[model samples]
Target: MKKILMSACFLGQKVRYDGQDSLLEHPLIQQWKEEGHIVPFCPEVAGGLPTPRHPAEITTRHPVMVVNLIGEDVTPQFLQGAELAVEKAKEVGACCALLKSRSPSCGNRETYNGNFDGTLVPGSGVTAAELQRHGIPVFNERELDQLVEFMTMQEADVA
Candidate 1:
């Protein structure tokens, strides 16, 4: 069976920056769980960041660089965690990742602006970028259908 990297919080794991789990309950996710396709991860937490840590956003005008919103310094911890996630994906032979959106380490195509202006812009999170760079397809919660279709096609090809 093929494996898939999934956001820990989405699987009801308490690993979000806010110390709360996203706890998304979806039929597809449940099915995947039964099939043992999920490899849960939280890059921010894996990087040794505490829950309820400082909320961060991409500020370097580039999504690839993660920095402190107020201080503008690189977040080495987050980067480390993202790298860990990529490593985990590779170890598991996961071809795709399902990540939480609007997160500093898991956002796929949109993240929050650091200005607290309630603005969302196109970007990829640290972990998302690492996975993409390593040839893993990343998707947000909204893209579950697409993920299912893609995974199904890959499974068929394998068969």
Candidate 2:
């Protein structure tokens, strides 16, 4: 069975910056759980950030850096986590990841800006960017079914 990389928060884990999860309870995730094809991960946590971490956003720079509202640079940790997530995905031969939306580490599109203001910009997160660079398709909770369908197509191709 083809395994999928997943954001731990979506798996009902309290790994978010606020120590809470944005649970989607999507059926495809449940199905994947039943099949044991889910590889739950949190790039932010994996990068050494605390569970109740200071919320960070992508900085306005050439190579975006993750910074908290207090303007502390956490880019190395985010990059580390992203790289580790990629390694894990490769280790399990996962071709796709169901990531969190609007997260600094796992967002697939439109993450928060680094200004600490309530705003959004079009872009992928650190982990999402890494996964995409490695050719792993990344999806948010809203795209769970599409991910399932895409995975199904991949399986069919292998068959």
Candidate 3:
């Protein structure tokens, strides 16, 4: 079975920056969990960030700078986490990724605009962008159905 690189919070793990879980309750996720196809990961925590840490956002798009609420540049941690995520994806042979939306590390298509005013902008998170650059298809939790379809196509091709 092809493994899926999934956000730890999506599987009810309290690895979010605020020490909470997003908990995706989709049937496909449940099925994959039962099938042992989920490889859970949290880029922030894996990159030496503690739980309940300060919320950060991508402040610079060109260089992918991440900064926290107090204006401390956390770009190195985010970048290290992204690199480790890509390594993990390759090590586990992940077919794709399902990440948390608006997360600095896992957001797939849109993330916070770095102003902390509840605004979203079109962009991939650090880890998500790295995964895509390494040829992994990334989907956010809202795109579970689409991910299922993509997995089905992948399976078909393999067969």
Name the top lDDT candidate: 3
- Candidate 1: RMSD to truth: 1.8
* Clashing pairs for predicted structure model 2, backbone only: none
Query: Which parts of model 3 are misplaced by more than 4 Å?
Result: none
Model 2 TM-score (2 dp)? 0.95
| Per-model TM-score on C-alpha atoms | 0.92, 0.95, 0.97
Candidate 3, position 75, lDDT: 93
Give the per-residue lDDT digits (tens) of candidate 1, residues 38-101: 9999998888777766677777544355666456555777789889998999999998999998
lDDT of 2: 0.88
Local accuracy of candidate 2 as per-residue lDDT tens digits, 59-90:
86468678886778999999999999999999
RMSD of each: 1.8, 1.1, 0.8
Kindly report which residue pairs in candidate 1 clash with one another: none
| Per-residue lDDT of 62 in model 3 | 96
For all candidates in order, the CA lDDT equals 0.84, 0.88, 0.92
Per-residue alpha-carbon lDDT of candidate 3 for residues 1-159, written as tens digits (9 for 90 to 100): 699999999899999888999999978789999999999999999888889999999998898899999999999999989999999999999999999988988998899999988899999999999999999999998887899899999899999
